[model samples]
Target: MSATGPAGRVQPARPGDPSHIGPYRIAGRLGAGGMGTVHAGVASDGMRVAVKVIHPEQAQEAEFRARFRREVELSSRVTGPHLVPLLAADPDAPTPWLATAYVPGPTLNQHVLAHGPLTEGNLYAFAAATAQALAAVHAAGVVHRDVKPQNVLLTPAGPRMLDFGIAHAADGTSVTRTGVMTGTPGWISPEQYRRGTAGPAGDLFAWGALVAYAATGRLPFGSGAPDVVAFRVMSGEADLDGVPAALRRTLEKALAQEPGDRPSAAEAAQECVTLLASQATQVVGADAVPATAVDMVTALWDVPAGEDPAWHLPPDRSPSRKRLIGAVVLAAGVIGGLAGGVAALLPGSTGGGTHTSSSTASVPPSSSTGSARPLASTAKDDKDGTAANRQASNGGSATAESWALTRTAQGAGEHDVARAVLHDEGVVAQELGDGVGFSPKSVRFQESRREVYLSYTLASDEEGAMYAETEIARNMCLTVRDVVLRLHPDLPYRTYVMVKEESGRDPQVTWQDDFVANSRCRSAADDDSAQDSGTDQDSGADQGWQPDEDGLGQAMIPSTDGAEIRVADGAARKIIAGTNGIRRTLGTDRVLGNAEIKVGFDPGNSVMYVWSDYLEWNQEQVESWADLAAGEACRALVRERESAGSAWPYSRYAVAEIGGSGYLMIRSGTATTRAACPA
Candidate 1:
């Protein structure tokens, strides 16, 4: 809930903090750092802006003023939709101050930690937007040396990148600290550590790490002491476990040790946009704002504003200024809110944090202080309701779940969103149970994973296994259709169909996949309409159960050893050709060394296993890789059969495996459209 913006209440101004700096009236404290303090201020025209004012002692130093002037210049030169626009600055003032347009939302780090990692459209959108932001930064000939989660604010519109404090011009006209490192430990580029100065490639490297953090809610380089984390960054060993495969490939290229090996900012942005296109239902142009991402980010704003806290100023640290600046600036671009005075508070106005909070602050000591503190929970119920209402107006589809919710602390009406989700979940459970001919033991929606889990008891027999697989596929498509039509179309969710032989036994997940209703299933009304119009081939029904190429349903069943597996050379050729087409369209160049396509017919199993090197990528990446392959295969199969005047014989579920060792089932059904879970 914490973000650098004008909507939330702020801490009361400290005694030493200026009430009026330039033409802006300081209302309250936004943050503080080594550079100065950031204040929530109002202009003469009543427009709210984050005002960053240098400390009186720092203003006395000529070198400090020159650096402040350089920051103002750099901020002015950079312009983009994803950047916090600088409004004004005056370096010659007794206390140098700068102001920037305030945006209301939580930082990426805060949102990920409070909620969880981003998924689906939100993740894709974030990657595209942040990459575009960097494109702009680079285009302006500015190298934003500090590009991390704390610097990216998630707003209802999209993400806005902050903190240009240490940003140096590509032409080297800026006054950067020559002796100190200018970026966060885990996010810094290897070349920066080796050469002492970072360029646009360094920002792109940070972008790779930042996107990975947003998708997984963990640092790409695992967190530890600054020196240790820096060592990992320099070693070029990033843990991209939870990242999607196709996207992970892009990150891998971006994280390459050599600067020339990394893709340009524009190229990276286009790549992200391409990935977003692969998961979109409708035609999304490169410039289109990702609506689902906007909605997901908007939901994070539905929290009550906190009461302003009392501000207390720390004692001066003039004696240790040099050492403090050297150490703290290298670790976190800015320092403020420290017990010691070495760190000063700055507001979002300046865009770098040294203090725990600031006008434009850097990342905090831990993960908490780099931006605004998380929203407090003490406001009136009506106020929280108002925030929720605003969220609705902003097109929030999913309700924001508090980091930790308690019945009493949140009050009676606070659980409305949770209750609503529960009600919808029950509805889905009932529908799925009715369709599959039995009640599920449990149905739970995990917001963090963006998945719905439904478990049912089935007889331990061949008939039961077949029935479970068939019904689960058919019903999962139907549920996806229902969710898209009656629930949230903007939010993508995976449906996990789990089965168990006995009530006391642990459930075995039969299939789980993100099925786009538009391409995989049709409403009952639409099905009837398609039949009546003699356009069944074009309807979603075409994606349902179908016979084998030999006009046999059960005869195509394969053995456990895959000995009876059959492959149509023509179908295989079509699939491979389609995969290449996709690769070309998306500009994906990463090819696994031992990439192999093993196609076979197995009616009894009805699962297509895609095995890959586990050491190179994790389970999620493997699944993502399989999903892409299967989607291409699905389209190719449909086309090949259609050309032969027949229906697609294969209804195989795609599953991912690690080097053919472990089975990691992925999709319940095939992907019939580009979107992962299109409406």
Candidate 2:
């Protein structure tokens, strides 16, 4: 074990001790740890700084020296308002030390010890700020292996995180040895304790434990020997004696035993901020003025409501106010891993990939056509393929069937093919991969468009991996699907419609012959390959049509004018009729006018539509138009109209065998026009 101060008493500094170390003037000894001693100091300009120097004993260890060198390099690159800014360092010196902007405040542990338990509101605020700090740290691709209350300082500004002694850059040369835990016992995640593989999630687990302590003045695993505490943490049990009910769910999730089970610092920060905001609103009431809220509110005002505060900070402060300012600074610094060169490691650290082993599947370039043949199989295929193939061959005579699987890739990758296949069967496929592999289960086919999503995992039984996996998978699936549909024009898709007033109301349908006539006219102008008038005459005459009761339906009206008719109301619904005569609704109000609709077909009469809603805002109309007009214009862009035929009211707008759905934008008069999917 490392030596402590004589009799465990903090060593006192002598006046004649070298006043200057490198560029800093040593003022006083601040504290001492197992590996190093910290001294209060200042630059030539009298700028306060904290200098941490390696102990002579530890300096003899080559590994420790290298780690200290890495610490200097990492500290220099990390910058944030909440973190103690690393001003200088000299790793090559006989006595290595790092000088950082001095932050003055009581350690969080000291504060809790002196002041008792923190109020629920303050605890929530602290958690949020600390989570944000950790986010910054994680973003930098570094993990503060030691995330204890003692490492956190509560300054006047908020919180400033300190002590990166145990922090390791994701790509740094140093590798943790097995069975060597770098974190405090009680706050370490199960993975950290057992595997010595501390990552961003492990830091999040520590943050959760620290928050639990701050809120209730007690560790979640009860105050006991490190071994017992480690046992409890590894067993996935927590002692939430005084934790608030509102925060229990979040804390429980974050405290899950597995590293994969814990909520991300980003997510935790969001929840903490939300919880804090709710508590603040309750305390100040709805009628309270914004200006009088806590100083934290001032930082939150200019950014997103729950945005991490690591991105912004107040100006510099004087020494007298350092303690208060330092608290906030420390709070900000807690996001240690989110900035600098460390950020590059975040993507791979989450551990996600999707590839059928031993099977070569090539992603076709540009062209849509491709040939798929079964190749070499692996253990997974051997266990499931025979049954799957048997079922596929015997289950139905139809040419297409629905299938679903959990997405295991971080972003767009091979996992999408599975989703596409499931969609072809009219099944709503949900994604399951969130950079982190938390949720391990996925349900491919539910009841029609409404599918059951399952996230049960045997691995999660040991911790919160199940919950984390599920949330990440669902969120990743949604994000990837949405992004792909938005950016790729040729992908078959649909539009989203959000109704604030009518959550459960089934959509109403309206059809107009005038709208159909206008669609035909516009199609003639837009489609260069459209059949000439002679072809139109023959096809129009052959398909004798009649209008519906509402002067809509199979109408054969021909027009020469290139005018497109559209619906003005956003609440309108559009449906494209497929070969099976099933009408698939394309756009909801939210997705209307902003995205285009693409439809795909299967041999079994099943149709799939890919919705891409990438609408650019018309700044002029947005600024000048009335709310209703602006809303309509936005919707129009999403639900733009296109015609299939050249004849005015002929087969142009015919709702026959619609294989897919799409939108076309057009400038028609002063008002923007929108077309509803054919009902």
Q: Per-residue lDDT tens digits of candidate 1, residues 197-244? A: 688898899999999998898888774323334555766768899899
Off by over 4 Å in 1: 1-7, 165-181, 282-679
lDDT measured at residue 385 in model 2 versus the true structure, 0 to 100: 35
Task: Score candidate 1 by lDDT.
Answer: 0.47
The models' CA-based lDDT, in order, is 0.47, 0.39
lDDT of 2 by residue, 310-412 (tens): 1111233323322111111122243332221111111111011111011121111111111111111111343323433343234231011222321222222
- Model 2 steric clash total: 68
